[model samples]
Target: MKHLADLLLLGDPRLYQSCEPVLESELPLVPDWVADLHNVMEEIRAMYQFGRGIAAPQLGIMKRLIYLNVDRPQVIINPELTAVSDEQDELWDDCMSFPNLLVRVRRHRSLTLRFRDELWRPQTWDVTDWGLSELIQHEYDHLNGVLCTMRAVDAQSFRWRPTPTH
Candidate 1:
């Protein structure tokens, strides 16, 4: 029963490594992991005042799964970015794995993604909102072994932007 306390911290080697797809046989674990993600995300959001999404790898589970709380709790499994606009925008992105830091990064302004829902149903999302677009990209990076730190424009692009409570 992995909990909020078991998050793979910033320096954890696993956080820098790629993740494997969630196998059909492993689908049973999805609910538990999703629960953990939601629980931890809630805590982080309340503590920091922001945090709309999280990835499975953040919890040390190398699976292609991500959770988002846009209008509702959304579970994206085996997500694939089908299309990305050439247009981009810069934002100071933050992550649960490294809560104290913010990385200046550029992300697409719109995207089309294909993924499976919590019930294993195929779904497609055409995101146009810059905020959701960037959020998806951030979580997608985690699925592919990339982090905001790696996406930082430069060394100076990374900075300490700890939450007020911190």
Candidate 2:
């Protein structure tokens, strides 16, 4: 039952540390972790109106786990990216960790994700859509201690998120 407050914010040292893989013996712990990730991500979506996925490190879990709920809920554990396309797309990327900032970064247009599920079953997803590709890559980077800010296109690739006027 984690909340938005439990999310690790930008500048937190733990957020920059590479995560460890979830062990088979730790499968029992994944449900609770996924719940926390889901709760926090939902809160981010409600407050900021944007969030497709989140990684375990974002909550200080220090594991290679990702919870994504676009059209449905998906649990990705120990994910590895493969078959990444050379084609790239540049976009303004936002993160729950730094809700008030955006980074312009280039990402591969497509990639294949291979990971284990909550039940420890191996799974693979071929992501080709630009939006989904970007989202997956963003979350994947979190597991490797890479942030969008670290991938910025240039010195001028950073900007404050525009506040909404009600």
Candidate 3:
């Protein structure tokens, strides 16, 4: 199999649409997706140097899925973020899916998402803070043909990318 980055992440209209349904009956084992996902994570890790979490859909997987974990970096999550605080916060965000651009996004301050573990057992988690929340929301948006820049919610407000600071 090719490296995950070899997979395209942009200019695909699918990345801009709702992800395909993920059947709960066949949730993948952690070993199944994690290794590939980890490779993708490592490939883009530098883009997220000060950031946390990334998702496959942003890499253009049209599945009801994502991977998320904060600064801890010990895990790769899928079908992530089932329960998010109805309460959301707005914050500035950068994305591996969208490099060099910073956009303001709205997300729950906390969440409880469900997914299978490495062995494929159903599980849930509570998450808070900007990284996890923002990442989940960002990736989730990809599932809906949406991008973080869309958070600006105005075509005019969207910028191609940011001017990097030295």
| Best-fitting candidate, scored by lDDT | 2
The residue ranges of model 2 lying beyond 4 angstroms of the native Cα positions read: none
What TM-score would each prediction reach against the true structure?
A: 0.94, 0.97, 0.70
> Please, what are the lDDT tens digits per residue for candidate 1 over residues 1-166?
6666888888889888888998878889899999999888888877777789999999988899999998899999999999999999999999888888899999999999999998888999999999999999999999888988888987789888854954
- Stretches off by above 4 angstroms in model 3 are 1-7, 23-32, 47-51, 69-83, 153-166
Error of 3 at 111 (Å): 2.0
Please give the lDDT score for candidate 2: 0.94
In model 2, the clashing pairs are none
Selected candidate, larger lDDT, 1 vs 3: 1
Writing each residue's lDDT as its tens digit, candidate 3 over 29-83 gives 3344545556676666544444355555665555665655554544433555567
| Each model's lDDT | 0.90, 0.94, 0.60
lDDT of 3: 0.60
Q: Candidate 1, which segments miss by more than 4 Å at Cα?
A: none
Residue pairs clashing in model 1 are: none
Lowest-sum lDDT 10-residue window in model 2? 157-166
TM-score result, candidate 2? 0.97
Per-residue lDDT, model 3, residue 126, is 71
